[model samples]
Target: MISILFAVLTALSNGTASVLQRRAAADAPEEDALRLSLLRDLLRKGIWIGGIAMSAVAAVCQAVALATGPIAIVQPIFVIELPFTLLLGGLLFHGSFPRSVWLAVAAVAGGLSLFLLAAAPSGGDASVTTGFWPEALLVTGLFLAALLAVGLRVRGNARAATLGLAAACGYALTAATMKDAMARLDHGVGAFFTGWQLYATAAIGAGSLFVLQNALQAGSLAASQPMLSIGDALISTCYGVTLFSESLRTGWWLVPQLAALALVLAGCIGLSRSPLADGLAPRPDDRPRTDVPAAV
Candidate 1:
């Protein structure tokens, strides 16, 4: 029960942190295009690093959640990050938003709530269980890693989207593996880093996450973020249902989860294309950090 709560909150925090970091990234300044090196360096130092750090924290929280729940039940719920990002965007950044955006957020949130209401909470003992898919997962992870490496090294517009999607798949893979490791553990922190599998799991998860951050920093924040967010959910959903044994409740309620997914995709689209995504540009997102009032 406590684990479930942690998983849910971790999703929320991860999402919120992304939005906040987006705002920071948007505010970063580039004084010269010709001197791309200096300008890019400055922007990375001032904003990108902070944003990336927050995302790392989110990932750690996510790992904590995976230790408690199955990937299927936990991963989709992580989609909650998108709307929470929006909420954090609005509240912290003074970002001007349309009612439709808020509606989209609400729809996704409501859908997840409905889905959780139907789904049973994960309560299995920590014993590191992998169903029938270990070989498949290993194979897929290697393919994805190769794909991402090639995508990052290559140069083309098509390659950009390809890389984004590949990296997204990689992230999903990491999350799934992390969940597996957590399940394999014995009750406490003692088991946390004791096994080779857990360490490998954490490395893959964290490494892919860094790739995700690099993707964000390397190119269009708007283009990459939405695609990544959507892809994470889809890939994770597939893994969850097949690999994690996260069964969806039958009938009537299925529509709501489906609806929620639609809402999540829609919101990601809306946010990415939004004029307000200027918050995600290289400008300071409007909101206070502590003593200073950003809007004032």
Candidate 2:
């Protein structure tokens, strides 16, 4: 229960950070996309700095959650970040919530609930062996490289989605490494600082943030957010199972699990199409002048 609570807090913090960061990223010059210059530009924006602070909070909460529970359970809970982002965005930008927004929120929340109940992931090792790190890192690196290449070749929404998936992969690896590093605390603070996993987590997490910024700059939030939210949950689950030996019900339980996943996918898609989610709805200032006479 403690882990679950922390995970929920992580999701909420991440959602707020995404909204603020995306707002800042949207104003960056196109030439800065996918470059260190993007970060330099973002640093000038107070909103981006605020977002970074929220991300720091999320990171701490995530570390606590991973230490206290299986990664499979903790990571999947982040899917709620999607609804939280959209809802928060709506409130912050538009100051109104549409009916569809509420419905999409319900769908995401309900589907995630159903999936967790069906999967019931549990009983993972607190730490991974050093021997497994090489293979896991190699595979993850290659996959991220491929996605980055694809993202560079694309434009608009395609670029956003591709980079979003790459960021998701990076984040999953970060969580896995963070869990491994946190487990080292069981030894001693000295041991924790000595563990290579701690440094690796910081490096990977920084790279993920860079990719996520490029994703936000590439196109609309609707294009990137679904991939980010869903991809993270699924990829982290794989890492949990393979790296930490976490267990989930198989056999007949797979049926409900798949169904639940479908529900999540559908919900994500529906939310992505929402006007509020994409910032397509007209704000008070954006509304056209109604008092003007027809020129015809």
C-alpha TM-score for every candidate: 0.71, 0.94
Which numbered prediction scores highest in lDDT against the true structure? 2
> Model 1 misses residue 76 by how many Å?
1.2
Candidate 2 lDDT by residue in tens digits, 192-284: 999999999999999999999999989888888888988999999999999999999999999988888888888788788887665722345
Worst 10 residues of 1 by lDDT: 26-35
Off by over 4 Å in 2: 280-296
Which lDDT values do the candidates have, in the order given? 0.60, 0.90
Q: Which candidate leads in TM-score?
A: 2
* Residue 187 Cα positional deviation in candidate 1, in Å, after optimal superposition: 7.4
